[model samples]
Target: MTALIEIHNLSFSYTGAAPHDVFSQVSFSVAPGGVFCLLGPNGTGKSTLLKCVSNVLQGWHGAIRLDGRDISRMKPADVAMGIGYVPQNQNSAFPFLVRDIVVMGRAPHLAVFASPSTRDREIARAAMETVGILSLADRPCTTLSGGEWQLALIARALSQEPQVMILDEPTSHLDLGNQVRILRVVKSLAGTGMGIIMATHVPDHAFIVATEVAIMNRGGLSRKGAPETVITESNMRDAYGIDVKVLHVAGGVERKACFPSL
Candidate 1:
């Protein structure tokens, strides 16, 4: 499979702290229909990496190519056309209707001062349906529950018709059921050939949805490969400082789970 995004020799450092890089020599590639998970403990530059990939941060050195074009050379509008980003938290500052918020995703396709077209509305509607939030379209975004609001945010991004999606701890603060729901949606999206790059604290989430995994530690990815290999007890211990048991649970379809050895 051809990679939709290719990252190489990436490094980030704050000013006056050249000796203290946040993450150095970070590298990975994400192919269409593949989920490349970045899993690590907090403050390991997981979110920072996503920001750099999504072009939200600057002052980094390396190469990030989207569809054979260097991201640095792509215009912001061009980047928006191909990538969608979901942050860990949702903004409730506005009382905008769900459909309105979702429609905003069409901004990438519109000219300056232009509004969403009828076709854009149709696309937004489909996105809402895809995320299973069509019924909530009329509701105010601020009135949604945590899970529902996150669903709306996803729908908003989907409305952009992006080829790749970047999510940062998207399941944070949700109940287990909601987290599972979000992960399922993520898996479903990648099945349609949208490359997914997600930063997560949950190894189990990687096992659930990732086709490939990278374990990030201070300033680098320590291990990366298939979930079964990269999400091992040893790698988990190395990245998280916890001794864990990676168990294969017997079911109709075999499933993998991790538990801390206490």
Candidate 2:
């Protein structure tokens, strides 16, 4: 199958007084129904690369294509129609209802100056239900806990019904249970043939849900392969500069985990 998203020789740098490269020569692809995860330490440009893919940042030296169409030339609305991006959540001062917030995702599908139609509302409702947040529809966004707010953002992106989803640290700052919930949602979404690319600090997350994984550092992605192959002790030490033990438990529902060897 053709890749849903492709990036070749991608490089970016912030232009300012003390300019420096965030990452260079990064290449990857996400196939339909694939979960691609980027693992790295803080400030390693994982988030920057995601922004470039989403077209939120520009002037990079590389090519990004969605279904063989160059994203640089696509209109912003077209990008939104193809890729749903969920950036790190921020609190909004205005207390919009959750349903209204999710309905905003329909903007890309509606004509200019047009309001959301009944079908759009129905789609938004389905999106909410998919993320298990339909009960929060009437609640104000400001009243949500961190986990609830994150689910709302995911619902908003889901309402777009895009082919691919880009999530920047979807599990960040959440408790263990919520993190697992989000990971399960990610896997479930991919099971439905929506490509997912996520940047995360947790190595175990990649092991849990990623069909493919890459460890990114300052220069670029250092390793890319299946999670068990790419997220080993050596790569973890090289990427994070800390010793970690990658463990496999053979009990009920076997799984892999990472622990710092402090």
Candidate 3:
């Protein structure tokens, strides 16, 4: 299968008091219809890498190609059209209607000063239905719960109709049921040939839905392979500095970590 997005020898650094580098010579690719997970501890640069792939960060020292073309050469609008980004826990301070928020995804296709056409509304409604939140379309975004807000954000992303979807901690603020629902929606979308790259702190998400796993540590990709190959106990320890016991589950491995004795 051809890769929908490719990263080759990518490197990025942030300006700080001490000038810290977040990534160094990172390389990976996401194939069409593939579900890839980025796993690591806090401050491991997972979100930075996702932003680079989505073209939100610029002047990186390597290549990011989309459909075999250089992403740097693509305009921001074009990039937004090709890649849909669902950020983590977007708190809308103002009360925007849910339908208005979803319709913002169509900005790439909209003419300036023109209202969304009937087709746009149809697409937005369809995307909302896909995320199982069509009933909340008219509600205020701020009035929704965390899970409802997440579903609405995803609905907005789906409304973009991109070839690849990049989610940064999609299930971060949700409870177990909401987490399952979000992951189920993401899995179902991947089944329909949408390439997905999601940064997740939860190992269970990768165990259940990810076709491939990339473990990041110390500003680089330490392991990349199928879930079985990459998410072992030793790898977990290495990446997270935790001693974990790996259990063989019905379909995948369950990870249990041991804390240091006092």
Please give the CA lDDT of all the candidate structures: 0.90, 0.91, 0.86
lDDT of 1 by residue, 167-231 (tens): 98889889999999999999999999999999888888998899999988978998999999998
What number of clashing residue pairs does each candidate have, in the order they appear? 0, 0, 0
Where in model 1 is the C-alpha error above 4 Å?
A: 16-20
Candidate ranking (TM-score, best to worst): 2, 1, 3
Task: Please write out the lDDT profile of model 3 over residues 199-235, one tens digit for every residue.
Answer: 9988768888898999989889989999878888888
Give per-model TM-scores.
0.96, 0.96, 0.92
Model 3: lDDT of residue 68: 90
Tens-digit per-residue lDDT, 1-262, candidate 2: 8999999988888872224378888999999999999998888888889998988888887899999999988988899999999889659899999999999999899889899999999999999999999999999999999899889999999999999999999999999999999998999999999999999989889888999999888769989999999989898888888899999967784888999978
Clash pairs, model 2 backbone: none
| Model 3 CA lDDT for position 154 | 90
Candidate 3: which stretches are off by over 4 Å? 16-20, 250-262
Checking candidate 1 for backbone clashes, the offending pairs are none
